[model samples]
Target chain A: MSGSDRTASLSYDRTGDVRMSSSRVVSLIARREILTRLKDKGFIASSIFIIVLIMGSVVFQVLIQSGASNVTVGLTGAPQGLSAAIQEQADIFGLDAEVIEYDDESAARAAVQGEEIDAAVIDGNSVLVSESLDDTLGAAINGAVNGLALARRLVDEGVDPTILQPVSLDVTALQPAADDAEEVGEKALVAFVSILLLYTLLIFFGQFIAQGVVEEKASRVIEVLLAAVRPWQLLAGKIIGLGVLALAQLVLICAAGLGGAIAFDILTVPGAAIATVVQVLGWFLLGFTLVAALFAVCGALVSRQEDLQSVLLPMTLILVAALVLAITAGQNPDGSLARVTSFVPVLSTMVMPIRVATGSVAWWEIALSVALMVLAIVVVVRIGGRIYAGALLGKGGRVKIKDALAAERVS
Target chain B: MLEFDGLRKSYGANVVLDEVSFTVAPGQMYGFCGSNGAGKTTTMRIAMGLARADAGEVRWQQRPIDLEVRRRIGYMPEERGLYPKMPVAEQLEYFARLHGMNSAAARCSATDLLDGMGLGKRSKDALEKLSLGNQQRVQLAAALVSNPDVLILDEPFSGLDPTGVDALAANLAERRSRGVPVLFSSHQLDLVERLCDAVGILAGGTIVASGTVAQLREREANRQLRVVIPGSDGHWARELGYAHVDSAQDGVVLLQLDDPSRDQDVLSAAMAAGSVAQFGWRQPTLVEMFREAVAA
Candidate 1:
């Protein structure tokens, strides 16, 4: 719209214009923050680093898992059917075993000592080894040898050995475990990943927002901004802008991690992983808003960048505590500490996500925790906004929160 | 028209502004003159809605200035500030948008303002890359980018070189011609004397004196006269009984008149003594008026 048309309308409908202009101001500020930060080398580097870290971890795990499952077994003068039997038994045990024939026991022993093969089976009656054998490989070799012996006995008794097929009884529990071992492991992984991502992002974005607020104050840009719009608008714009950036980075990292895990067949349950991502993202919004508001207040409390660390210490400690609680929740998701702290606002941002991921939290618990966090966010934002406005124009090294609140009342 | 009607502000037990009242009518350039800690910045902040006035309001066209009107007012705070990492042109555009201009209009305004300030080539450069003088110009451009209806700048001319000052003066003059009311605070009295149509002298949290320059001068000027008698002793006015000599140097005597109506009589008395070369009522400059106002 033309400047004249806008100005005319501004005066023509005062009440309506106020509502429209505030949002416009906030968006303008938010856009500036986004554009400016996009050019920052630090922002780009951190984002790239996180994505590579996530993908790299997944690839490394896949390699380790593949390498761990492979086994090479050496044989010396073993029966023809024995190699095939060993291969079939190893397959049942989920091991990829390769049996290689040797001219004699000495050669097989020498191969095992050289570490080329994991172990050796010498004659049909005896199983050979270097140092010791793993239980899975031992069981596979034992089962093969016993079956061969039993068949020989049947032949000696003039019975049909081909009809002597092996059988095992089917055992079932009335009520199985809620989560299988693999599912529990998957959930634990989700808990760890979600917590780590949330912790790193919350801290990164919290500092970004705080430093941003201080940058304005130190540069004295707040004066010009406050002239056109209210302090709350500036605060809101900064939080929303940085919050979106933080959320985007979180999503990118989660998606890359999830995609990599699935591609490499690392994650058994993809749905749970996706749900964890959603929960982390949802909690992150509330968490960032809560912490970002306080960070802004802390930033306003100081007039210089050098003083930021001291003022930020308390909030940083709180975040660190949450991080610790989140890790503990991952290990003991149903523990009393995790359960109780999952309802606390700042701590819940971390603990609740882990609890949810690990399947220890009920739907009502999540809802109540979310509601409490939302309430805390509302109160924190309101108070923080006041303190921010009060201390924004204040000059000096440090301002007490009490003084800022008092100043806010006067203003 | 912008009116700051009885704006009062206080910090703790100390009052920074006490019923500080003044107005800049349309097309008028009002100069705010005060010593250090005289509440000039505070008054301007209140008008811009950057600070709250405890007991009064800043009204425009007899209406209290709300967010809409505040966005329309161009304000440059005493503390000069802009995003140092932001490109100069983009920073100005952001400010324009904050003042309620749409993106396209804001862009146009920012580009034009930057070019007008001779910063066209450097518009793409970060603000911090510019010299302090150039940065100051960019700050001014930010204030003017929205083509504001009212202008309130605190210490706008401080630290500017002569060329920069002239550039700013011209910009302000153009705005004044376009029916915009401008209020700027400055320690530079001579520039204020030459530029502002009305002047307000604030001291001890109050406007001690404020009016048109001529009106203030007239009010503060003592009933004194200066007469140059080339061939007579300078004690002629004292001997005439209607006036007494205030000072005398270089054959010209400065007289403190006992009455305003006796000026012609004194002139006749000077003619009776010798040939009169020069005679006029002595008026004080703005600096003198300010010193006296603050001192009082």
Candidate 2:
């Protein structure tokens, strides 16, 4: 088929040219709401003021990192000349190691017991010992003590100390997988960022849709506009318009806040996290459209703003439950509950990113979650749009959900 | 021009409009007069495309009124709506934008309309902060801000003082002069009688009496016009074959003219008699006509 012919076949005729609808009404709606919201003192001032707070928090976290735990080593015997080298290793490991002079081995043991030092290192002829049951600590000390003992043996065997030490073994990790420390740090950073973005977006855009609906209903302005636009179209406009607004704010914060950290090397995220960012963004859009649409519908059902929280409280509880499940997913991305909710529309927006960050899930699961979310958004738009249209015109009375449904069914 | 064709709507079992049909022509001021539950509100809502009718359609010209048609139609609902917290200018601009004006144009037109309404500087004031009269004035401005081609206002003059009433009367007349069709519903029968070229009286979801005010007045054959003059009024009445002289006040004798057209002879005779003064026509008011319609 020709390109035009294929498109013609693909696109069905809706009451009017649905194609032309985007720029025609959508632009007007977006421009009106965005301009008014941008002029709002809350949006403008908080956007500026919040970033300063976040930047301050970042600085405080970095400062706290500087005062890491300092430990002391009580060494019983330092096989001649190894003391200085062992001290270098301790400093490299980001710990403070002080060699304490002990008159007897019992005194060194007492020092470790009395908490005067972190550990007591007693040098036997070939073995090394620490007081606690920590074998790794004993091993680490032994490695340092043995290197010094080897140097002493070489000198005693008539080899020059400098010549014997000519060959040096610089310890290196054998496998890249052993670098779980950096990986864990990277995963923790991703988790924090994802959760922050998810919660902020939900709150920001949810309020936008909810409050916009309340405004329209309150002024009874909706009665006039319902004459022109279809119910769904109006609801869709507010959701999409404010969705664009919240997205713009997110991009701004992400650019300045996360962007600065990534660029400065204070934070590092995985390549998968990058891909997950894009996926998470899609889910963000989907989840928000669904949530915001539902809130708009709820807002219309109520006559006043005071009743908003009562309706919203239940929805908030659902979100909290989903977030809890999302955290559970982050810790174990492949667990049954995590895997299932990760692909579920409501929970996936918060869960899927962490899953992608920590676990190797099948690519199809990501696609399925997105597909399900898209479906959820469509359903919300249809159902919520109908309810909004029906409920919007009912003034001075509660908008009965049953009545709205009945009206839709009858029409 | 907006036209409702056999429009029918009901709430539960109560029919608000049953096959109601009417045409509001361009540049003519039409009044909708009805008692409570007389389907006046429902008809106007249907005409404005705000409510759905079970059976017929509301058409602009021949086709059903679409969004484009709706945009060109201004409606002031009965409840006196203005965003209580929104500033006057912002509220007006929002409605204007919904009617297809861009933000800048909407703001400009809204500002100009507010200034013309004598609410210029108060445009920044919240709607609730304004006095009730001024708030109503802003509501009127909201309806007019879009410069709609057809205006449908429900009870647009109910709570207004004389000045407010005059403003509505003059504004509607101005719009009519500019070739806009204006139809409004009101219980103030006197105002409706004075302002409308055509009046439709509805009762029980149907138009009971409709046509020009003159036609409705002419339909009330039982009502008679009384003409009066001073001195020789009794003799003049006898000459004109009048049944009786009703009364006299301020040297003006009341003569019951069975025919409203037989006034010229009385006028000439009164001049011949002495000092003829009270010469005018009084059509029966809509309150009387409404009572007649409701009875039917």
Candidate 3:
């Protein structure tokens, strides 16, 4: 370490002609965030878990639907064409019914009593059952028997059944037709799933952004990062990077759920389910951006992880409230409360997805909700970016938001 | 050239920097010396654009520094930091890329810098896994990864061992020779004196004195002289009416001369009092100069 040796300096050879563009700086920062989280075992494991849960639910629904749809019935001394008549009636009612013929009434009664068949129609006149007949199977058998007796009477009276015009009441309601029970059940399920995914992903990704912001401050690395780029750029990079990751995960889970349901024939209307998935993804981006900006600001307000919860409480509460409202909206998607809340910014991201899944939201309502969410995102990011820039370098404890706003811009 | 032009900053009613201005020319190393809370870190932060100056701007090559230009300056903050969980080489490469190096160039630069710092073997280890000294070296390497055009380091030499200090000094000297302006603050005044071509002594939120080491010495009044008169008892110089005795030890007396032109008169007076054993002008060291400046 002599003076002469100190004079023998190492040469720093400059290496490239590349100059960093602002977008490139943002992308570089984003790339770092993405890589860091991608390596996180928790993030990876949670994503896989969500997808598996969705696929598992779809499989469970398939098993239940198939078991509930099949029915078996026994027949004894059935008249000519009676078996075909029952089959036709079951087919018209969308039932998967199997009609088994016994050698006599005694055998048919014995089969029903033994529970080998769900019920029995003896001599094409009376229906016997083990305990009580399945309503759908009983209706099919009654329709077949009544239709056969009417045809026989008409022939014996020498009346031409075709000429005596078949009559059925042409029913109409003054109001729009209500969704049948099954359809309503399907819509409710769709709403529940989409809203739950939106709520969960929103909160999960929001905390990630918050933790990320605090990590840099806690480690005191924000100062070095702020030196080369503007604070807004750093914040933007974080939001966009984590936002992309969350979006990818949401898409993966949605695809898994939809694919499983369609493959197992659980979802009869694939088109509607696919549309709900798209809407949820779209709402997710908007909602995530809105919350992420605030989370970043809140995170910058604190220098330690222990202090993060208090700072994050307000935003977390907002998310919880959104989740509750979304659940409520799922139950009453056509109610005015749901209708109006579906247009609110943060609430809309949760509620509107449910409304859309129920097919109760108009195109303009969705468009308005999305537009408002985007607007909210812009405003939040603007103010939040400032606070983030202003507070990121503060040391110790928590930085007051007012002071942070008044502080000098990092750039 | 990098210039901090009349920068002023205050926190509430507490003024941190007051009209602070200094410049580091191309190929010049400017040492920033200040006591604790003397605004050294603030000035450097302002230069790096990590903090904004209330009244002035930092300029390079006669233009004000903006975000784009700031990317060209390598900065090390007072608080030593990098992503602790990130591997050494990856962290360095990330910093290099942030400063505008392309991917391949960043990777190459990171490798070379790590090898130079003797951290080549631990490049794949997380930063926290390295010993404190090695972490300090990696911090330095992060600042130099992009081969920045200007280096603004706060307390860059505070924790380095002698060998580490020498390596960093040599590295900075090379950058200076290559026409990069370096402004680094340190508590080690002797090192600043040895390494910087020019130095700025900051006190009470302002640069009270700044120039080459020799220029600062020349600007200081009252030169000290060490005179030895074997039997004089050390009172002769004070009795001569043109000097003050700063200290007296054994037979040698340290005298502060009121005027430089009277050195010969003091010499003749010492000779008349007794046999002169030694007489020489004692140049004030940077430590001494620093104390005097801060005290003033």
Q: Residue B265: error of model 2 in Å?
A: 18
Ranking of predictions according to TM-score: 1, 3, 2
DockQ of each: 0.44, 0.26, 0.45
In model 3, what are the clashing residue pairs, if there are any?
none
Tell me the spans in candidate 1 whose CA falls farther than 4 Å from its real position: A1-19, A70-139, A146-176, A409-411, B220-222, B231-233, B237-244
Fnat of each prediction, in sequence? 0.40, 0.22, 0.55
The residue-by-residue lDDT of candidate 3 on A244-318, one tens digit each, is 898888887787777877787777777666766776777777888888898899999999999999999998998
What DockQ does predicted model 3 obtain?
0.45
TM-scores for every candidate against the unseen true structure: 0.89, 0.77, 0.89
lDDT of 2 by residue, A1-411 (tens): 011222122212112212225356666666667776787787677666655665665555555543342456666664555556557666656545576756667888788777777676666443223445344434446667777677777878998766854457787877544335666556655565656666766865686678778878777777666655566667767777788887776667655655656665456554534555556666677788888887888888877787777777777777787788877876777799888888877788788877766766688988898898888888877777777777887776567887776553212
Candidate 3, B1-296: lDDT as tens digits: 78889999999899999999988899899999999999998898888877779899889999999878888888889998889888999999999999888888889878887877777889999999999988988888888888888898999998889988988888887778789999989898989999998999999999999999989988764478889877677877768787888887778999887787898998999998889999888878999999999999
Name the better of 1 and 3 by DockQ: 3
- Candidate 1 per-residue lDDT over residues A292-410, each given as its tens digit: 89888999999899999999999999999999988888778899999999999999998998887675567899999999999998998888888998899888889888888877432
Cα displacement (Å) at residue B289, model 1: 2.3
Better of 2 and 3 by TM-score: 3
| lDDT for residue B128 in candidate 3, whole number 0-100 | 95
DockQ of 1: 0.44
Interface RMSD of 1: 6.9
